[model samples]
Every structure is written in structure tokens, then in C-alpha cells.
Target: MNMSTKPENKFSEYLGNDEQGNMRLRLGTKFAAIYVEKGKDIYKETSKGLVKVTLEELVSKPWIRENFERERAFQRSKALAVGLQSSHIPLRERRAYKKRMGWVGAH
Candidate 1:
């Protein structure tokens, strides 16, 4: 009858990157898509095709919540790295400069 069982491992499907090189998630039956709104709130595309679900609803699934936080941290790290690279100053000096400018600890 071809009845498919759920994946035991949460990360069984490696969805990989989309065309724009943004990493996508393997939402499975829990979700269809993840959307980040203003103020960093999260929304998930529900199975019934709902788009603007609450952050609480989104976080109900452990893997989805984990992935969301991981994605956010990765982006922040990338921004910091970019900022560090853009400046001609040395790494040590840049750290001090960014700290003084209130950009380092703020993010």
C-alpha cells in the first residue's frame, strides 16, 4: 500500500539551499515555510496553508525552533564577519573600534 513512516531522525532530509543561496529547512509535516517578520518574530506556513501563525505556534516543534535560532545566529555571525572584513584596520583594532561604537555587544 506504500504507507510511508515518519523519519526517526529530525534532520533526515537535507533541504539544502534555494536558488538565491539561502539555506532552506526540511519542515516535513510540521510546516511548509518559515517567515521572519519585523522585530525578528517568526511565522510558519501551516499544513492548512496558514502563513502568519504566532511565534509560539512556530516554536511548538522542537526542530523548527532549533533551526530558526541557528539560522539567526549564523546570520548575525556573517554580519559581524562582514563588518570586520570591510574595515582596513587590523582585527584587534577593529574589535576595539566596534565595541566603542556600540555595535559589537548590541547585536
Candidate 2:
């Protein structure tokens, strides 16, 4: 397989709790969502109720996985901005400061 055509294995990164300790993903709109409880069990919201699902099944849908990944990235950026602001780091030095503090990939 060509490296350019190979899919990246980022499933684990998107399947965990956020900084806020919430293990949930909003599916497209707020009307639907997915929740993961302890032990990695997954559930999805439906017109009827929550339905159990497998991690492999969930991530197989490209759109669903893409949306989840996008959400996770947004959350991480928001958290990083908050952390830098709370630390009183200047905007100009945020890049250098994050690198120096070893937080660039600490996540």
C-alpha cells in the first residue's frame, strides 16, 4: 500500500475522555450523541433510546469518525488556549512557551 493512500490509525486518540472528563460525542447535531462508559463500552442515541455498539463498527463510518475527530481537535485547541491564558503566557510567546514547557505533545 502506498503511504499516501494509507489510513492513519487514530482510533484510540478519538476514543477517550476529554480534559473535562466527558466521554461522549455529539453526532452531527445535538439531537444525537454517543456515550462511552468505563471499560470502553459504547452506546448511541436513537429515536427509541441508546443502542450498544462496537468500536470497530462505530469508526467504520468515515463521516462519523471524521466528525468525532474534528470535535476532539476543537476541544484540544480550546483547552490549550485556556491553559495558556490561565498561565499568563503572552500571545507572542505561546508557541515557544508551550514547546519549552513540554506541552506541545503532552496530550
All models, RMSD in angstroms: 8.9, 9.9
Model 1 segments more than 4 A misplaced: 1-41, 46-49, 52-60, 95-107
- Model 1, span 1-107: residue lDDT tens: 56456564344243554565544455554544544333344444456653554657755856665765676678779889999788788988877978999988856
Q: In model 1, what is the error at residue 49, expressed in angstroms?
A: 5.6
Clashes of 2: 0
Angstrom error of the Cα, residue 65, model 1: value is 1.0
Error of 1 at 10 (Å): 11
Model 2: residues with Cα > 4 Å off, grouped in runs:
1-22, 28-41, 46-50, 54-60, 93-107
Winning candidate number (lDDT): 2
* Clashes per candidate, residues 3 or more apart or on different chains: 0, 0
Give the TM-scores of the predictions, in the order they appear: 0.44, 0.45
Question: Which residue pairs collide in model 2, if any?
Answer: none
Minimal lDDT window, size 10, model 1: 31-40
